[model samples]
Target: MSYVDLHCHLLPGLDDGAATYDDTLRHARRLHAEGVRDVACTPHVKRDEFPGVAVREIVERVAHAQRRIAAAGLAIRLHSGAELAHADALLLPASDLERIAQGPADARWLLLECPFDGIDDDFALAAARLRELGFGLLLAHPERSAGLLAGDGLARLRPLLAHGALLQVNVCSLLGNHGLDVQDAAVRLVREGVAFCLASDGHPGSREQTLQLGFHLLLRAGASSTQAYRLTQANPRLLLRDGVTRPLFDVEQRALAAAA
Candidate 1:
């Protein structure tokens, strides 16, 4: 089955992703080979120590990359998006925010990345503010946040989930590319019904086979075949189409299952 990647850094020379036009084309072909036909070229926006492109420029870059992919005889499709870091993302103008949405001009999905160190009160406030602005938020890599993994870490994410924010886990995290802790969290999120989608989050030098690997791993870790398909394919498609999530594992039941 073809997959939809909601978070990938495939744009050339924009932030820490593909470094050149050639790299962009190569990455596209690789993801296509792995069954990823549709990808969101979601480069980091306003991240510390990394240069983020403006939303308009990011949209333009995706278009340019699409042309290059077509010239190279690839059918991979690219969409415009940005992984907005919590702090500086607040500073982006409303117009730029409108430019970076995935589908139509009114698409509500906004891919957001919380700090790697942890999620705290301020970050939650920023996310809440974004939601208030009418965006249906999709969180990126909550597994990597140490604070979210500590004592009641996953518990804290429930309120956001209840409010309509979907979580997107990195496939590499499930494969231990990050670490055991992150891998554990990733698998648990999928198995317990907390995470809505699995993404490659691929950069220039990463593996193309992660989509397949993560899918199988999720099954091994207790995800049903249907749930596996949902995370890798169906849920992402729905998010792209509707800018909202409907994971096979019910979000409302997560806490109940965990408590039991």
Candidate 2:
């Protein structure tokens, strides 16, 4: 199956993602060429800086980008959603979370951002609250979290996973660009069957980096291609669906075999 990038900075002039419509178009073209059939335009909903960007505004902007892509005859489908920062969690009204939770192509999963600091009980409670309010959470790049990088990070995440939260690790982390400890943690997460997806939290200037490289890293680390595909493609597709929780073991086993 063609890949779908569940997390990306594709929307033009929204936050620090793509700076212009042309830049957006360029990224779309690149994604299509890389066989990315769908992409979520995950502009930052960081609480510290972009508080003014309401959920409705993000939806409209995403719709506008989709229109532009269609007009330009790009084969790739662009979906609108926000990479909502942890700080913006409670700040966004329940209604707004509902609106922003909409995925690129009729998807139900929300691409949630973790705080740069660490995951805490409050965050976990907030996530549970969101679930209670009927939104599926796809935690973005937890490998970057210092707590997750520490010895006991996985223990903390185990409960969240049981609570229907899916984990997303950035492709760059696998490359050790974030640091060896993070890379080790990211590998361990995949190897131990913790992370559900590996995405290229691709910025505008760094279009050359692809999730394919991350897939290779996972495979080399003993993940089967099927598992890698599931994390990089299948699971993400399901995530884009109605945010249903699925078993991770089968795919991880398949991915390990494929890697072998």
Candidate 3:
């Protein structure tokens, strides 16, 4: 099965991602060559930079990239989304949240980027607020946060997971590129059934350095190709196609059973 990169910085000139359209196209072509059939253009929507990347603009840019890729004969599918930073949580209105919660196709799942700190009560509160406002959250790249890897991190994250937040870990964490702690935490999360998905989180220029390396590490870590495929492909498809709602996980079985 072809992979679906759920957390990629592919939009050109949008934020700290691809600086040029050509670079974005080059990254898309490379992803296609690596067997990624679907790529979400998750430009940063943080408090610092890219505060102006509205949903409409993101959609338009993704459409433009799609056309360019098609014209270039690349078969990869480009989806539009915003990586909502934790700090930006207080800044976004409910409507803006709804807009970015889904993709261009209005898939209800939002790609939510957590803070570098870790899962905290504030995050749980934010998750609760989003839930109340009617959006499913996909917490991005938790493995990079030292706080999340500290004492009883899983315990700290349980409430958020229970409240319908899905954990997304970058494949780089599993490759030990971020360090042994991140790699160990990632593997432990996978083992404990907290991690529901894995993404490349590939930036344009760094595609070759991260994307394939993450996939290779997941495969070597004893993830059956099918299992890995689901994380990289099926789950993302669900996020892009399903409406906003918490995904149903069979916590007892340590697997996602369906989308709720």
Question: Which structure among the candidates has the greatest TM-score?
Answer: 1
| lDDT comparison, 2 vs 3, better candidate | 2
Runs off by more than 4 Å, candidate 2: 103-107, 206-208, 245-260
Q: State each model's CA lDDT, in order.
A: 0.78, 0.75, 0.73
Candidate 3 per-residue C-alpha lDDT over 110-176 given as tens digits, one digit per residue, 9 for 90 to 100 = 7777777766777667777776666777889887776665665556766667667788888778877
Cα lDDT, model 3, residue 159 = 65
lDDT of 2: 0.75
Task: Report the lDDT of model 2 for residue 257.
Answer: 43
Distance from true location, Cα of 37 in model 1, Å: 0.7
Error of 3 at 119 (Å): 2.1
- Assess every candidate by TM-score: 0.91, 0.88, 0.88
Best by lDDT: 1
Ten consecutive residues with minimal summed lDDT in candidate 1?
244-253
Ten consecutive residues with minimal summed lDDT in candidate 3?
251-260
